[model samples]
Target: MGIKIGIIGAGGMAAYHIAGFRQAGAEVVALCDPNEAVARSAAAAHGVSRVFGDAESMFAALPELNAVSVIVPNKYHAPLTLQALAAGKHVFCEKPPALNALEMAEMKGLAERNKRTLMFNFNNRARPESVAMMDYVKNGEAGRINSAQAKWVRRTGIPGFGGWFTNKVLSGGGALVDLLHMIDLSMYLMGYPEPAWVLARTFDDFITDRTFKGPWGIPDAVNGVNDVETAAHGFVSFKTGQALSFQISWAEMVQREEVSAAFQGTKAGGMLRRLYGADGVDATATDLCEFYTQDHGRSSNRVVTVESDPDMGRVRSARNFVRSIEGTESPLNTPDQALILMKIIDGAYASARSGEPVKL
Candidate 1:
């Protein structure tokens, strides 16, 4: 039989997971959420046969499920993943891995002990432009990236003032955690080096300002928590002598929304970026990928081009998870890598809190 899968959330992100698994030839047998009506609606829309009020009931009822896709709030990422893994199911979880390094480490340990495949949705790695850039990095073209800069900033892009996104306990942090794709992409291109220390700071200038709310249309809660930072800037020094600087923000004084990673390597340097005409609107975005090098002492700049991906490889990454389970494709990311990413994020927050650099 083909791979059978279940989804652990009935939120908007679950649609991407469902589409991806179905396209990858996996049978999406069930969807579960605390809101039964919402789960049932999503199931009907996606052609899933079963809907449950909780994961435990879904797992108990669907004994044939061999895998699960987790698309929930950041706080529940680790717990849901651990639950699914303990039930002998391979798991694909949404980004940021977990709220902090400790939780991520525990999830990694459980997945290892259970011997189940645990992959996070580091979707940018699977993008067409990113794939093209990697061809150069892996083939000795962009040799040993020595330094990199990752940015995902917006002038007016706080998701919501009083939503879960602004609740540090629920969403981990603000823009640093929510818009972490660029940081992960930069690290991926740099080979995910071991870090020695991090120096960083966070800003919450516009945290409570509804004027800076994003265009995603997520409503604000009337009386909800909004205690996370609005922006974060950090620098990391890796054990390999490489370094990275990052600027992430949900709201800031900027020209527009920009997502990018630029790197300097021993041989060549390159950049991958997406510029948005409006914050949080994919339709108004423009992507660019290019490399810088010298040929016979003459400056040579090569622009890499590919078909644009509006989903930013979300579906592709999920499909890759299915293929990896089938032994046809290698997973794009591992739990160990996620642990490393989380460590850096945790360190950045710690450094910001203490107003001093944090040592890894």
Candidate 2:
């Protein structure tokens, strides 16, 4: 039988999972959300037979569920994973895994103890462009990755002014966390190097200033505490002595969203020509999303480039996860790697807060 999958949230991403699972021939048995109407609506729309508000209740009722896609908020990642593991279900949780380092560690530990497959969805790492970049880096096509950069820049995204996103207690932090997709991808491409230390700085006033143009085009004057930083920058040193600089902003008054990773190797180098929805600050572009690379033999400083559709990443990631659940392959994003990502983020925040470099 195919892998029996369950989608645990009815938010915007739930539909993506539903469609991807169906395309992969995995059986999506249930849709769980607190809202009955939302649950039923998702189930009906996705052709799922089961819809339940309470997760524990649904798990008890549906013993055949083999896996679940936890697409809830960052705070709920831990509890939901723990609950799913206890229910004997494997998990594919969204990025950042959990709210903090402790919770993330505990959930990963629980999954291991239960012998359940716990995967974090770092879909950006699986992007076609990223795959091509990885090939170049691993094949010595890009020499030793020395100094690298991974950044995310956005015009404006002070989401739901007074909502959970602004509440650091709920979302952990703002753009630093909300827009960390590039951080994960950059780390992956760098062979998951161990960070010796990190220095981080954050800025939260951009949103409160109400001078930036909003992403969804909201009014100039929006109300919120802006407790979370709308921007964060960090520099990291790896055990290999290689370094990576990171930056992400949501409320900046930049021309456009620019999300990318640039890797500088000893013999060769490359970068994500375009990442996320970013069009490389080009307003009249459709964002082809290229992966460009340059080797030692090339002196022009211009790398060769390859481009493809960007929307295919989510589908590709979901298909991989479902296949892993069916025992046809191993988990795409292992818990070990996910844990490392969490630790790096945690260290960055610490360094940013104490104004001292944090040893990772």
Candidate 3:
């Protein structure tokens, strides 16, 4: 029995959703995008038999669709998801579930009322490296995690000039939104610790003003009103006294692009990233048992070489979500977990707003 799936939003990410759904063995029945060309192109690409310019039209025309993968802008997530749930479709929405906590709660309530499964495309959690690390920590391979850090730092990069990403209303926040998975991965390795508070600061350089005087490629000085930050710093605390910090920049005065996460515990420590590695306190990999030893009245450091396979890390989350739909398992990226993340992010912004620490 093949599950019928419809896709909303025909953006760059819509393609990924189509691919993941196909990989999960769902039948691509319908496609919806505001742009007709985009919808047609996406339908052709995914072998979806139908296409529409709006989700309401798609839903009304294809009421038999069993599931929907929503990959729309942040502002429309709540209502779109609510309608899908009301129409009796299991929903897999893109991350940052809604614009805020209240919106999240509304959708959550709808899912409960409609008895639908609501999950996020938190592909970060589905990665094999992340799974391998979770197994290691839970098996006492990394000891008790006391501190962790995650970074999806990129050199100078920002999407869309005069676009939604740079506008707070459309994309929520800047680097935090982009680095959400970075933050998610850290807590995931620590067994999904309960976040207690967020202390954060956001920074926005006039990258757009200096580079593209107008909208990206639009070339109009009057259109330079994207007020979102280009970089951010966040310090978070968990219920177990575990601490997490992150540094991420989408566009800034920087030199390179690198992504990684670090876990520190009592016995062993581990780190993951693309470039530029920094070992943490009491953290040691299998081979780096001596890089940071107890040196009385002395200090030293050594480059640690850890082995990892990044490619194989992307299929687990898909399997988890698919199996849950197949009624053989439960969802890993549940609606509740997505709400937890949104709360943390909301707290981060609140902290930045009032220049004070926010208790979770």
Candidate 4:
């Protein structure tokens, strides 16, 4: 039989997870959500036969499940993932693996001790352009990437304003947590350096500005509890003597959104963009990977054109995780890498609050 999978959330991401898993040849047998209506609806839509009001009930109901996709909010990642690991199920967790390094480390330990596969949904890493760029770095073509800059800025895209996303206690932080794809991919392309320090800043200027609320915005009390920053910027120095600068914003006064990662190396500089879909669903345009360097004492620019997966690599991520559980392949993004990311995020937030560089 194929992998028996369960989905632990009924949100937008959960829908995508279910479809991706099915496409990867997994049987999505069960789904769980605190909201009964939501869970039922998702189950019906996905042709899943089992639905539960909570993860505990689902866990008890489906003892034979081989794997689970934890697609809930940031606050519940640790608990849900821990529960899944305890149940001897391979876990596929959403990004920012957990709220902090400590929580992520605990989950990692549990997965390791249980001898189960644990993977992060850093699906963007599977993007053909990302794969190509990473190959360049790994093959010594991009030769010792020493400096990098990544940014994901939106003109007005506050996701679910006045909701858990804006609550620091629930979501950790806005923009930074939601837009971490850029930072994660940047670090991966830079060879996963060991961060030494972080200096950062954040702002909340557009939370109350209703004019800037876009498609993903929601209405709530004007003075709702929005304790997180709408935008953030950080500079990280790695022990390898390399450095990275990153910035992200959910709402900002800008002409258009910017999503790109540029790396400077001793041999050649490379830039990659469109790592994800335009609307984060499907790729509208092909990925762009460009290289710049001096050839024969003359500046030259090369655009490497390669075939890219039309699915934006989402399918690959889901399939690879399942295959890893089947012992067919190894995971590309593991909890240990996510732990490194968490440390950078924690340090960035700490530095933002203390106005001093935080040592990792």
Candidate 5:
């Protein structure tokens, strides 16, 4: 029999998980959300047998569930993950692991104590181009990665203009949490080095200005809160003497949206670009991966072609999670890695607030 899966949070992210689980051949047995109507609708749409208004009830009703995808808000990640582990269910949590480093660390410890597999849904790392890039770096084809620059900028984009996404207490932070995928993938490609310190700055330039809200119109801006930064820039230094510079923005006055990462090693360099538009969809363009090398004392660049499947990583991640539960394969995105990445994010925020470099 295949692994039995459950989906928490019947929102858009849950739908994303459902597609992947189905593609991976896992049976989604249950669906849960705080909103009863949402849960029922998702269950009907996804052909799930049961639905619950909350996670506790879902876990209680379905004891046979082997794994669950926790696709809730950032603040609930730690609590839900811990509860799922204690209940003997492996958890696959959505990205930005938790609201802070402390919560991530606690989740990691709890997962270890329960001997449960905890996986982060960092799907971007599973992309074909990303896999090839990782292989190149790990095989020493790029030598020791020393410097990297990654950016995910938008011309005018702020999700949920005044809702939980723009609220610091609910979503952790703005661009960092929402767009940290690029940063994490870049670091992963560089061997997951220990972050030494970070010098960072954040700005909330367009929160009060309605003109900056492009696609995500501000219907709730008046009553809702907007305390999070709209843009963030950080210079991260690793213990291995390597470094990365990143700038991510939710709303800014720029030419166009750019999602790209470039790494320079001691011997060679490489770059990857996702050709999605400012809305992050309508991919009329294909991804580009290029490597810079010196061949016979002459500088040369080679383009690496990767098969494009936007949802391939999510499907791969679902299959990998099931394999982990079966003890056939280890998880690719572990809670330990989440904790380290959270620390870097925390340090960046602290550094920005104190106006000084924060040490890890």
Candidate 6:
């Protein structure tokens, strides 16, 4: 028997999912979106013959679908995932998991009760640079990481003026939630220790500034809500006595866009970074991965080289999801790790609001 897959939310991310699943040898049977025309267009483009306007109709019509890929908005991730899990289907969802920790918990619980695989697209973990760094960490060459720094800052990079990315209710938060890859990557390399507390602050300095819109081409809404912060800085302490500091922003007064994660371990330190010529444009980015250690009591820096990923592991991560379901590979991220990530994000927002540290 082969893996039969259905996709929910026929949007930009769904195209990536379709490509990945097909590359993994899975049969993409159907695609669904609220807009019937969009769904039909995507299905035709992807070679899928079936199309529907909603998830309920798709599920009711297709009984052989054992798995689903969810590429919807932040607000629909949980409900759609729970629905799929309850219907006895494995699920692969996009980043941030859900709006907050509570929603993530519900999604996790339902998946467990249904005995289905639940994975998130923490695609950075599948990047060649990240894969190289993990080999060293797992082999004890990096030793125990004591502290780390994660950053994804851009100098004029708001996604849109009034899209869901800027609405707190729809998108949860701003850059902190949308650009959470580095934070999750740092924690993964550190063995995913339990987080204890978070102290943070957020700024909306450029939240309503149209001049800072990103180059992605997502059009601005007419008279739409834009209430999310543009920047967030925070620190997290874990139960293992390790710590992580992060800076995430869509708009800030910076030299250029940078995505990086640096960690200091007991024996050595390492860094992985991508410097971009322009925000939201992957073609203009340069990547770096290196390790710092001692060679005969002298400082030594070794550069880790690998083939560059144009999609930043987006499609590769999806293939991993399919392979994991086939029992040929383990998932790069688990539901429990996603829950922790959301908890940290939730804590950061709460701390920012109360002007004090939130103890998780």
> What tens-digit string does per-residue lDDT give for candidate 5 at 1-360?
888888888876776677767766779999988888978987898788898888889888888888899988788988998889889988999888999999999888888988888999888887788888888887888998999998888767777667778888889998888889889888888888899999999999997666666575225555788898888999999999999999999887777777788999987899988655645567564478998899999998988887877674777776677777777776778777888899999999999999999999
List the global CA lDDT of all models. Answer: 0.92, 0.76, 0.73, 0.84, 0.84, 0.92
- Model 5: residue 234 alpha-carbon error in angstroms: 1.0
Task: Give candidate 4 misplaced runs (Cα > 4 Å).
Answer: 217-223, 275-287, 307-311
lDDT of 2 by residue, 1-360 (tens): 877888898877777677767777989988889888988987888788988897887888888888899987777888999999988898988766887878888988888898988887777876777877787777876667778788888775666565567777767888887878888788787888887888999887665655453545223324544588888999989998888899889877676667787887776666674533343334554344333444455564544455564454777778778877677765557887777777878898898899999998
Model 4, span 123-226: residue lDDT tens? 77887778877877888877889999988888777866677778888888888988898898889888898999999999998876666565763455455677
Summarize candidate 1's per-residue lDDT along 77-112 as a digit string, tens digits: 999999999999999999889999999999999999
Candidate 4, position 76, lDDT: 94
> For each candidate, what TM-score against the reference?
0.98, 0.90, 0.84, 0.93, 0.95, 0.98
List CA RMSD, all candidates: 1.2, 3.1, 5.9, 2.6, 1.9, 1.2
| Residue 50's lDDT in candidate 2 | 88
Q: Record all residue pairs in model 5 with backbone atoms less than 3 Å apart, i.e. clashing.
A: none
Candidate 2: regions farther than 4 A off: 209-225, 275-283, 286-307
lDDT of 3 at 11: 70
- Spell out the clash pairs found in candidate 3: 126-317, 127-313, 128-313, 161-216, 259-273, 260-272, 260-273, 269-283, 269-284
Counting clashing residue pairs in each candidate, in order, gives 0, 0, 9, 0, 0, 0
TM-score of decoy 1: 0.98
The better-scoring model by lDDT among 2 and 3 is 2
